[model samples]
Target: MKRDVTITNPVLQGVFPDPSWMWHNNEAWLVTSSFGQVPGLPIHTSRDLSHWQRRCSAIDEEMARRLFLKYIRTDNHGIFAPTIREFGDAIIIVSTVMEVMVDKALADGADPDEINRLRAANGNFALVSRDDGLTWEGPHWIKGAVGNDPDFFIDADGTTWWTASRPSSSPRWPFQSDIWMRKLDTERWRLEGPERIIWHGAVEGATWAESPHIFLKDGTYYLLAAEAGTERRHAQSVARSDSLNACYYENNSRNPILTHRTLGEGFPVQNVGHSDMLRDDNGDWWGVCLGSRVVEGYSFMGREPFVFPIVWEDGWPVFTPGDALLRRRIIRGQENTRHGYQLGDIASQEGKNETDRDRHIEQINPNDYLMLPTQPQWIWTRVDDFDYEVLFNPTLMHEARIQQNRDVFASITTDSDSSSVVACISNKGTVQEIGRTALHHDEWYSVRLVGRSVRFAQVPAPNCIPNTEHPLLVGKGAAAVESVAAGGWPVINGGLDIPDSSFAYADAAFLSTESAGGYIGCLAGVR
Candidate 1:
């Protein structure tokens, strides 16, 4: 008799992006891109990758002390994508921290070489140690240029090696780049051999590939790299070699192992690539990567993590459309979640009272919240980095729009003082901060969205349009108004409403809707 089953995604929900993993002893350590613009990268751990909890970050104050003494940079300079590997009794990490690119360079133009050099100058690379994988140290460079998409592995003989996109020292031109590798002495953490270029691709129209994660399985070394481009045209490919340091080439058995279309239309966005693969403690395989987001019509460079479940088929890994969420638990556990929905009481009740909570909660309930087919990255925030968590239901919205009749649903929670709950609305990329009368206890808040044209009953609506000259003067200094694309924001009922100071509205599931643009917008802060 035949049997049937279902798969679930986002093994680690909420902002756990660009994931890579390694097993040390009996425990599994997972690392991901800590695009410090929002929150630091979180290292998740699990006896089985299915049930992951964040352990810590690849960068912290103590880590800074161990790597570079008195090292300081805004959240932008610390760390970007990080990968982990265990060598014998020692565990090491390879990281890249690309300084945040500003709008000016993106505005007039950007020379890829200029961008690369500037990004590297502000970048830091290193491998650190921790008796407990919770914290890391060592800013030691591996005798090469600062590279992106770094992943490492070890042979049975305890030989440590590193492979990264554009791993060698050279200015990257259109598509004239390659993935490079080097053998390193485990003790000193330095490169040994002359770096070798393992593979290369086109550099003109759609340029070089990146984010290579290699794993040795079943006598065949499988190499997975981000190919195509990282825009609406992201893709992934697989290659193999008999030896790790030897010549490895694309399998050619299949052109693209995966593509943005293969994943299906999810979350009304595009641009998905840059992945890292890993094996769970239970011997299951997974891949995590980043994706660009489209909301309404505008685009955002979101660092989303996608998990791809792996199974060997005819000597290659194959995945189902559902198993292709960019992120999916290899297996599900029967462990009952103790965290229940406490914010449900006020969900439908529209009032002046503010709702807040730090943990993620779905609108309505688990039954009403539809988890998207594509797995989504999840993160837990403290009062410091992100202070609020929110949920909203567009289905519940009932309002009139100036142009169109559309409502966006999502949930929100925040950590703020007991005096007020900050609420806001984004009009043409400009955010108006308003406040509500009530503040949630334990730093949590909730908002039930009734309609796109609707406003919170307590706080009145503000003019939706922005003022003249893009002059949004903050404090005493005059700052140019950061323009948000009006063409991309989802069309909704008109006018701006500041019911409360700030609130967050997120899709309950990965790829919540086919909104034809960015998924949602949120905010959390102390008032």
Candidate 2:
């Protein structure tokens, strides 16, 4: 028998979270949470789960401004989990525009008028696109749907069911929540009929039971939900019942079908939850979920989308069968390709040189650049030895920062007069500048890395900054490292671990989750 080939995990990288998967038109489609990122509700398509490409953002500028950006208040406060489904002649998406709490806003002395406006704008809503998401219609605020992570389920008899999670109407404990359902009046664009609690949770004292998705198979209703919040203790559990509106019982044998909470903080993939499932053309079950790659307790990259193989036994789903923990790689075969999938060598191809890699880069039209929102979408290259000249257009004056993970390795502020470089590190939430240097205006400069030391020079002439004799900053100071470790987080002693040890950088470890101090990852891009 031929062995399956190994492929990288987190198929969709760089902070794509709350992934919802569905099979439509014989292809795999996905939508993930956008938080504060604009041009929100990104839709991705994959012929085979192994290789995926972005189609277009389902939420456009007009919709984004009207529904989310107008009232956005915090970094992780907008655009929560979105569920995409093919309904009738159009594709519909159900999501929530989360806003600051009214009490908190009032306490902060926010204008009552604005606070009321924000409150009116917040809540769960729906959008439909008939032209493959090129155009959209109706943010039709679902009148009765209350809570986050709402999902749409169309029953066999053509009845539409809306499922969501919210704090219990009458709470017995703190953070107690329940999953409930109601008949969705699709034509009227609102939820109709009486609401009923379907499942409390899989376990006692489970908190924040949200991200509810209902799956029906063989005269049974399987309700999947995420509980314990989306943190180190995040998890996904299942409950089942014969009827849609009746109470469901937990799958006690395997309550939490998936989670990384039991693996401890040392494990690489942490905080795994908010999962969605689908079956491929080959009838094989697969799943996608949000997880983070934690390096020494710091997860700077934030929650990313990871794919896993799933199997059903006794009417329940098993994620990554036989594996207790999420792996960095998985074994797959080419035989599992979808209907129109042309198998590629992506799984086994040798690494390409940068020049060879550039050929595959998608070229975006210059006009389309205007439509691009100011999100931290980045292109990264990791290396121990790099020599490149960066031309900072004097007229633009855009401030760009260089990072070695969460640490601010250096920053360049350019203006018409001249540019200055500041080498810095972040301690707790405070930024401390370690050194500074000045460069001639409109001059081409080269930055090179030799081991842990970063050197700067004027191009062609090789004149170093200040005078021609000194390197910019050597990795000599341990004060930054000491301060960071003392700040009460696990510190990776040696440098950042490059999975491929072909390169090494000692201070790369400083760029981590603890140092970043936000829900999002350390970003490197021009704003």
Candidate 3:
């Protein structure tokens, strides 16, 4: 098979993490964890693995709210990693709804019983779609797999299997876990046979041996999983057995088949684990995993999707060129080739009079105002979809000239006095609020910022200084000079009040990379 000379590293950008893929009807369909964001489980489709387009969300807000009410206002509490597979004519998505105990819940006086109840609520679910993934039916709850990152597999003989990470009965550490597998009774939508602890971590006392996925090749069962937690040390491990119900499985000689953890903070892609593999139409093995692009030891965009080629050696799948920093351009096998334009062509195009005329025309406008469009370049905190209209752009970088001009402006209106539109800049790493102001409700307002000065106006009226003594611009360093803004409820008295309704109109020219500090620059949008 031939390979493309270069492929982009992150096939899908932004906070799409814990990727799962399934090939159906001669095309690839992928899904990722939403983590309490509404419209849970976004699905994307691609003919070639290199290019992808979002098809539709597998679960919507109404469905998600009905299924996981405990996730409301909870950070990192909702749809964990999902595994997509084709069982006969139906496509099945097995996933977990995680509502784990956290410091915030403890600080708010949550008892052990309440935490246990939340844990009990966290279980695996199966959603089936028949019409080539256009619509889904029945998030039919699966009882036995009581853990996070569930993987569903169907054997060649038509027997269904389910696997997940469960709290270790004899744990070595506080939250030690092991991967378990069981036969699924599809007719009843539950596990039928006894649960078996198939494989643990590569090391005896390894932690977080989760994200289990099972595959069969040439009569050998390949069980793949992620272990060592999802931080700088995150990695993917594998095990294999001759029989599906083998008493013990053999760990791969090369245990951590894929990871960039040891490459250090200098490598752009960090936290590389939680992967899923697929065989392309051309019979070539390919895999997709989650990795974060860090800058100066900070990653603001969260975990993004990365793709790599896989090769089988000695009956075991090896991530080709095992230990190296994932590059921005990846090369893969392909057939057809189209090499047309080069740098010189781009220079010639730029020299054209029409190009200069177009540039001059756009400059005459001076300001570029944009409303929330159908497909905007916005990366949400966790959830993919939002209820209100929000214009978000998260691609600003230090090299990008967002601070060419000193003046920034915004027009906004709110439904409640407590609700306010905020415009400010801060570092992505700390998300520190630099230049910002709260707008009054029920009136059209405009926010203007010129250097260190910030002003607000109720349209028709002259701009006035804010009555509140709180400084909108408070941070230090480059973050202090750069500006990004969000319009919603302000943090009042140390906590935020969720408003009923709020709206903000923005101009992108004023939102700069300098204001939005952090590793991946600042995210400018409305909350």
Tens digits of per-residue lDDT, candidate 1, 68-180, equal 21222332233556778775555677776553443444454544554444344334355566565655665565554446777777776667777777532453554555777
In model 1, which regions exceed 4 Å deviation?
A: 1-7, 25-27, 37-39, 64-77, 100-124, 167-176, 201-206, 262-270, 280-282, 291-301, 320-523
Model 3 lDDT at residue 73? 36
Q: Report lDDT (Cα) of residue 143, candidate 3.
A: 52
Clashes of each: 59, 2, 20
lDDT of 3 by residue, 295-369 (tens): 334443457778777778898887734333344445455354222101111212212321222110001110111
Candidate ranking (TM-score, best to worst)? 2, 3, 1
Instruction: Please report, in order, the local distance difference test score of every candidate based on alpha carbons.
Output: 0.44, 0.61, 0.55
Pairs with backbone N, CA or C atoms under 3 Å apart (clashes), candidate 2: 406-511, 407-511
In order of appearance, the predictions have TM-scores of 0.58, 0.74, 0.66
Superposing all C-alpha atoms, what RMSD in Å does each candidate have to the true structure?
A: 13.8, 8.7, 12.4
Stretches of candidate 2 off by over 4 Å are: 1-7, 100-122, 333-396, 402-411, 414-419, 424-431, 442-518
Best by TM-score: 2
Of 1 and 2, the candidate ranking higher by lDDT: 2
